[model samples]
Target: MVSVKSLHGSAQLLLDVAGGVTRIAERTHRTIVREINPLNRLRDIAGVPSKEREGQTYRFIQSTMSSLQQGLHRSLDGFSADDEPTHSVHSEKVAAALNGVCGDHLEASNNPLAITMHFRNSQGAKLRPDSSSMGATFPNAGPRIVVLVHGLCLSHEYWKGHNEADLGIELQRAHGFTPLYLNYNTGRHISSNGRELSEQLQILVDTWPVNVEELLLIGHSMGGLVIRSACWYGSEPKLPWTQLVKKALYLGSPHHGAALAKAGHLLTFVMHKFRYASPFALAQHTSAGIKDLRYGNLLDDDWEGIDQDEFHLDIRKPVPLLAGTRHYFLAATIGDHPTDFSSTLVGDLLVRLDSAKGHHSDALKKLRIRPEDCRVFEKLNHLALLDNKVVHDQIVEWLV
Candidate 1:
C-alpha cells in the first residue's frame, strides 16, 4: 500500500520536473526564433526595443503556467491528510531510489523523501542510545564497536546480502564487537554528510553504556568518501571518537573521482556548446552530491565557487589518513584478471582502477597508502565487493 505522503510527493516531483521542462523548452524556442530573425537580433543588440515589444506569446505561456501551478498547489493543499508514520519496506525503497536521483531537489523543497541519519539494528528498527532506549538498542553491545556505512542509493539493509553471511554479523560472532549500521541521505554533499557523521559519532561514543575501547569503520563506495570526510572533520578539534578509531577500511571507493561523473561533466559541456541541444541537456543536470563525486570532493572548500558545468583539473586537496589509525583500501575489477585492459579501464564497473587506488598525478590529491595495505579482487563488480567471502576473509584477517 502506497502512503498518501508518497503519492503526493511523487506527484509534486513530476509536476516540478514538467514545469522545468516547459520553461526550458520555451527559452530554447525563443532563442532559436529570435536568432533566425535578423530584425529581432538587431533590436536586441541595439537595445532600442521597448519592453512592450517583448514576445506576447512568451508572456502568455508564463502567465498560463503560473495559473496552473497555483491551482495545483491549492488542490494539493486541500486534499492533504496526514500519512502514516511508519513506512513499508517497498515504500522506503521507492523513496530511497527517488532521493538518490533528485535528493538535492527534494531537500531544497523540504520533501518527505529527504533522508536523515538513523542508527539501525539487524531488524531495521531505529536505535536510540538514551537512558530509556539504550538497553533495547544494544542488549549485547561490547566495549569495541564497529560501524558499517553503506554506499550511495542504499540503506543499511544492503549490508545483509542474499547469503546468510554478512560482514557485520560475522565480525560480531568472531570478535564480540558490537555492530551498528548508519542509514543516511546519499544524495547530499559528502562533506555535509561527513560533518553530521562526525558529530553523530561523538554522540554515539559519549552515550555508549560501556566505555568505548576501540572503534572501526567499514565503508563501501560513496560511504568510504563520507567516512574520510568525517575523519577530516573529526580530527580538526580532535574529537574523542577519533582517538578510539583503530582502523578504517574502504571497499571499491573512488578516492580520486568516479569516471562516470567525469563523463557526465564532459557531456554537459558539449550539450551546452550547441544552442539547440541546450534544453535537452537539462536531463543531465544532477544533484550537487553527484557533482561532488566528479573529483571526490571531501571538503566544503573543494566545491565552493567551482563551475560544475565546466571541465576543470582535479583541485581537491589531499585528505591524509588519520594519525594512529591504519587505513586499508580494497579495489575490485570486473576483468578476468587483475592486469587485464578491462580492469585498467573499467574497475568494478563504476570506478576506475587508478581512481579507486588513489593514484593521481597531483601530489596534493594523492592518498598515500602502503602497497601491502591495498588489495585487488578480480572478477568482482562494485556491489559484489560487499559480500565476497574472499573480501570478507581479508577484512576479518585485517581486523583480527
Candidate 2:
C-alpha cells in the first residue's frame, strides 16, 4: 500500500524528470538546427532578438509548470489525512529500487519515496532499539547475534524467501544466535550509511534484552562495502560493538571494485566527449552510492569537493579489515572452475573474481585477507550466492 505522501512524491519526481528531459531535448534540437544552418549559429552567437524571445518563451513555460506543480502540492496537502497504509512487500521492493537509483535526490527534495534505515523483522515491521521491543521481536532471544544486510536495490526480504530454508532461522535453530536484518537506503553514500549503522548498532547493543556476547555480520554485494565502512567508523571511535564482532562474512562483495560499475563510469565518460551525446549522458547519471562502487570507496574523503560527472582516477581511501575480527570472503563465478578465464574476467557476471577476493594490484589498497579465510564457488552467479544450499552450508561451516 503506497501512502498519499508517496503518491505526491512520485508525481513530483515525474514532473521534474519530464522537465529535465524536455530541456535536454530542446538543447539537442537547437544544436541540430544550428548544425544544419550556419545562419542560425551566427544569429545565436550575435545575441539575436529571436534567440532572446525564445529564451523568454522557455522561461515562461518553466514558470507555468512550476506554478502548476506548487498548486498540485498544495491540493494534496489539503486532504488532511494521516491514516496512510503501510507498504506491502511488492511496494517495498519498488521503493528499494527507486531509493537505489535516485535516493539522494529524493532525500534532498524531501520526497517520501526515500527509505529510512531501520532494523526490521521478516514481516517488515520495524524494531525499536529497546529491551521491550527486542524481547517481543525475539521471543527466544540469545546472547549471540548475527546481523544480515542486503545489497543495493534490495531489502531484508532477500535473505529469507517464502520457503523454510532461511539462513536466519537455521542459525537460530542450530547455534542459538539471534538474527537481525538491517534495511537502509542503498542510494545514500556508503560512508553515510555506515556512520548511521555504527550509531544504531551501539544503541542496539546497549538496549538488547540479553547480554550480547558475540556479534557477527553477513553482507552481500554492496552491503559488504557498507559493513567495511561501518567497521572503519567503529574502530576509529573505539565503539563497543567493534569489540564484540566475532566474524564478518562478505558474499560476492566487490572489495576492490565492481566491474559493471566501472564499465558504466567509462561509458558515461565516453558519452561526455560528444556534444550531441552529452544530453543523453544525463540518463546515465547515478547516485553517489553507485559512484563509490567504482573503487569500493568507504570514506567521505573519496568524493568530497569533486565534480562527480567528471572522469577521475580511483581516489578511494584504503581501510583495513577490523582487527581481532575474523573476516571471510565468499565469491561465486559462472565458470565451472575458479581458475577459468570466464571466472577471472566476468566473475559472477558482475564482480571480478579478484575484486570479490579483496585482491588489488596496489599494495596499499589490498585487503591482505588470509587465503584460508576466502572461498570461491564455481558454477554460481552473484545473486545465487544468497540462496544456494551449498553456499549456506559453507557459511555454516565457517561460522561453526
Candidate 3:
C-alpha cells in the first residue's frame, strides 16, 4: 500500500533524480564543449574568463531550481498530511522496481518509500510473530514450517505457479507444511537482510502457534544468497531457528556469483577509467545489494569501506552450508539439454550453471553438496523457475 509519507518521499526522490540527471547532462555538455569550442579553449589558455561567468549563471539557475523544488516538496507535505491512499498493482510494481535500483539510498535518506522487511501469508496479509496472530493467519497451521523468499525486483506476489498455485499453497496441501512468505527490500545489503531475517525467524520460532518440528527454506535467485547469508549469521550466534532448519534449497541461486552483475562491474570499472565515460559512470549508480552479486558477498567485511566503482579481487569470505541441514542447488538452462554449450555459458539466461551449482574454480569457495543434490532443468530461463509446473514438481519431489 502506498502511504502519504511515501508520496512525499517519492517527490523528494524525483527531485533528487532530476538534479542528478541535470548535473550529469551538464558535465557531459561541458566536456564536449571544452573539446569542440575553440573560443572556450582559447579562454582556457587565457585563464578561463568565460567559464567563471558561466559558472555563476549555472549556480544561479541551480539555486532557483532548488528553491522551486523545496516549495513543491512542502506543498506535497501539506496536501497529504493526514491521508494515505492505496494504489493499484502497477504502483506496487513500480515501488518494487525503485527499491531494487536505489533502495539503500532511500533507506539511508529515511525515505518512507524504502521497503521494510516483514513476513506475509499467501493472501498478502502481514504475519505477526505470536501464537494468536499465527492462528488467525493460518488456522491450519502445522508443525512443518516452510519459508519462501523471493528474488530481486520481486515480491511474494510473484510466487504464483501453474494454475495460480504458489509453492506455499501446494506445500501446505500436499505435506501439511505451513508456509510463510518473506517480503523484503532487495536493494539493501544481503548480509544486512540476512541478519535481520535471523532475528525475525528467532522471534517467529519462539512464538509459533505449533511446536515447529522442522523448518525448510526455499529461495530463488538473489533470495538464495540472502538465505545463505541468514543461515551463516544464525549459525554464528547458534540461533534456535538455525537448529530448526532441516533443508535449504537454492533455486537458480548464484551461490558463487552472477555473470550479469560481473559484466556490469566490469563495464562500470572500464567507464570509470576513462575521462569522457566517467560522468556517464555516475549514472550507473546501483544499490549495494546489486553490487554484492558481483562475487556473491555474504559478509559486511566484503564491501564495507571499499570503493564499489573500482574493480577488485574477489575477497568474499567463505561461508559453508549450514551444519545439520540438507542443502539443494537447483539450476536451469535455456538449452534443451544439459550437454548443450548454452547450458554452460548461459544458465537460465542470468546465472551460469557452475555458479548456480555452487561450483568455483577455487576449492575453498565451492559449496560442499553431494552430486545427487544438484539438479538442472533445461529449456527454462531464470524467471521460469518461479512458474513452471515441472520446477514445482521437482521441488515437491525433493521435499517429499
Candidate 4:
C-alpha cells in the first residue's frame, strides 16, 4: 500500500518539475523574442521589457503552488501521532528512483524522499554497531568486515541479487568475513557523500563490538567513486579506520570518467543552442552528483568552480589508489570478444573499457593497478558484475 507521505512527496516533486519546465519555457521565449527583433533586444537593454511578459504570471503560479504544498503538509500533520508508519517496497523503490534523478534538489528542499546513510540488513532494518544492537542483529559477526556499496539508482537490497548467489553472502560463508550493506543518497556530490561515509566508518569502527582487523570495500559503478572519495578524505585526516582497509575492489567503475555522462553534457549544450529546444534541455540539468560523473570526481576540488551548464576542461586533480590497500578493478563488456570495437566503446553499456580499467592518456590521471590486479570479463553488463559466479569466485580468491 502507498503511504500518504509517499503520495505527498511524489506530488510535490511533480510540482517542482512543472515549475522548472515553466521557468525554462519562459527563458526560451525571452531568448527567441530578443533574437527575432532588434527592438526587443534594445528594450531588454533599456529595461523596458516586452509587452507579453510572464513575470507576473510565473510569480502567481509559484505562489499558488507553494500555498497548495503547504496546505497539503498541514492536512497530513493533522493525522494522529500514534499512527504507525508503514514501509512498502514499491514506495521505497520509487523514492530511490526519484533520488537518483533529482535527489540533490530534494535534499536542498528537505524533501521527505531524500535518503540518509544507513547500514541495513536484508529485512531493511538498520544495524547499529553497539554491543546490544550488533549482538542482536549479527550474532556471528566476524572481526573482518566487507562493505558492499551499490551504484546509482540502486539500494542495498540490490546486492542480494536476483538469484541466491550474492557475493556478500558467499564471502561470509566461505571466508569468515562479515558483510555489511551501505545505503546512501546517490544524487549528492561524491565528495560530500565521501566525507560523510568517512565519518560514518570512523564511528562504526570505534563502536564495533569486536576489534576490526581487516576492512574490505567492494563498490560498483558510482559506488566505486564514493569509496575512492571516502578513502581520500579518510586518509587526509589520518582517520583510524583508513588503516584497517586491506583491499578495495572496483567493479565496472568509471575511474577516469563515464562516456554517457559526457554525451549527456554535449546534448545539453546542443539543446541550449536552439531557443525552442532550450526548454527540453531542462531535463538534462540533473543533480550535482550526476554532473560529477562526467569525470569520476573523487575530491571536492574536481568539481569546485566548475559550471554544470557549460563544457569545461578537466580540472580534476589526480587521486590515486589508497596507500597500504591492495586495489583491484574489474571491467565488463557486452561484446563476446575483448578486442571488439563495441566492447571498447559501449563497455557494459554505461562505462567504457578504458575508463573502467583506469587507462588514460595523461599519466597522472591513470590509476596504478597492476596488470595482474585487473580483469576484463566478456559478454557481461555492468550489473552482471554484482552476481556473476566467476567474479564472486575471483573476489574470494583475492581475499583468501
What TM-score would each prediction reach against the true structure? 0.91, 0.92, 0.89, 0.94
Better of 1 and 4 by lDDT: 4
Among residues 3 or more apart in sequence or in different chains, the pairs in candidate 4 whose N, CA or C atoms overlap within 3 Å are none
Per-prediction CA RMSD (Å): 2.8, 2.7, 3.4, 2.2
Query: lDDT score of model 2?
Result: 0.84
Model 3 worst lDDT window (10 residues): 48-57
Give the range where candidate 2 is weakest over 10 consecutive residues by summed lDDT: 50-59
Clashing pairs in 1: none
Model 3 residue runs over 4 Å out of place are: 1-6, 29-54, 61-87, 130-132, 161-163
Scored by TM-score, the top model is 4
**In candidate 3, what are the lDDT values of residues 263-355, reduced to their tens digit?**
898988999888789888853688888888889988898889888778789988889899999999889999998779988887888999999
lDDT value, residue 222 of candidate 1:
90
> How would you encode candidate 4's per-residue C-alpha lDDT over 272-315 as one tens digit per residue?
88768877885466888888888888788888777777878777
> What are the per-residue Cα lDDT tens digits for candidate 2 across 122-157?
556789878888888878677898888899888888
Shift of residue 237 alpha carbon in model 2, Å: 1.0
User: Which portions of model 1 show Cα errors greater than 4 Å?
Assistant: 43-85
